[model samples]
Target: METMLITGANRGLGLEWVRQLDAAGWRVHATYRDPAKAEGLFAIAKKSHGRVVPHQLDVTDFTAIDRLSVTLKDEAIDVLNNNAGILPARKKFGQTDYDEWARIMRNNLFSYMKMAEAFVEQIARSRRKMILCMTSGLSSLSAAGSRGTASKFGDGKHVYRTTKCAVNMLAINLAGYLAERGVIALSVTPGWANTEMGRADLDPGYSPDDLVDPVKSVEGMRRIIATATIEDSGRLMRWDGSTLPF
Candidate 1:
């Protein structure tokens, strides 16, 4: 059976992906920070008959990541989905919060790199051999260049955007390093899924129907993942299988 390791599987896109992949007969290692809070995931695990196992993990915890890596060392992981990340309140230009920036960078960027490094061995041994970092279209430098404010300075969410932008570059760098091992490394946007963060990304004028359904979003991303190759690596991809600029 295909094996998957996905972080932040307690809710939103991560949970949705876990649901879909588990139902499709995948042997999934779904990681979440808190077990008590992951009632949904726990319930899925209960009914999945050992296919959907939820593991405790905090993406920012390097030791925990290494521990989990060792635990799953014997298993060949087909897909390692770096889906855990944080999005906090932003500060204005001159009032930027350095601590907040550091915290988010740890979660969104450093943790992604750490996860890939920890699990690359198992991934290299798998059939699919993909490292998927869940990112956002809001991080697109190209979109920022073309749209947003009248100043053309880009949209806000300062700390979140910078970390995501940096993570996109990190994926490209990983692609080059892992290509020799037949690994495919890339970042992807889930489109405007109807999650808290997804809704937050939209403008105030948008409505409930404006957001992409999480099921459709994950399904499309899964299809893209199934077909991704080394040639498709190093590029940021939309859920619809199209590439986006850094």
Candidate 2:
């Protein structure tokens, strides 16, 4: 059976990914910042008959990451989904709070790099050889300036946008660096997902089910990842299965 280790598994898209992958028969090592607060996740894991294992992880804590790495050292992780991200309050240019921006960068970009560094070897030993980074359309420079540029669900904020852009660069850089190791690193934008970090409306005009359901996005991502080659690495892609410009 394939194995996936996902960060941020307590709620929203992360929780849904755990559920879907567990149901589909993959062994899931799902991490949450506060496992004690993860009652919903624990309930699902119980329902899954042990397919999901809740792990304690705070991405910003390198020591926590190292400890988890040692704990799972014997296991080969087939996929590493870098799904943890934060959206600090929005601001533009000089008005952007440096501290908040740095926090977002640390959580969304730096920690992602640290996680990949910690687990790349485990992934290399596995057969799937894929690493997926969750990114956003806001990461696309081409799309950033367009009118009606709000996220598909209508909430467009600058802090989230800038961090995702950084994430895109980090993923691409990893893809290039790991090319010789036969690992493919790619970024996927889950598109206007309906979560706390996403837009709040669930109108008929919006396909909130498709937008919010991490299962669908993940299944699509699986197909894309399974078919990936060195040629496909370092690309920014959408959940609808389309390529986006970096």
lDDT of each: 0.88, 0.81
> Using Cα atoms with residue i matched to residue i, what is each candidate's TM-score against the true structure?
0.95, 0.89
lDDT by residue (tens digit), candidate 2, 185-236: 9899887677867644333455555454666766777678677787888989
Query: What's the C-alpha lDDT at position 214 in model 1?
Result: 94
Model 1 alpha-carbon drift over 4 Å, by segment: 145-154
Task: Candidate 2: list runs displaced more than 4 Å.
Answer: 92-94, 145-156, 200-212
CA shift of 74, model 2, Å: 1.1
> lDDT per residue, candidate 1, 104-196, as tens digits?
999999999999999999999999999999887767886862223521333457788888889899999999999999999989988868987
Top-TM-score structure, candidate number: 1
Best by lDDT: 1
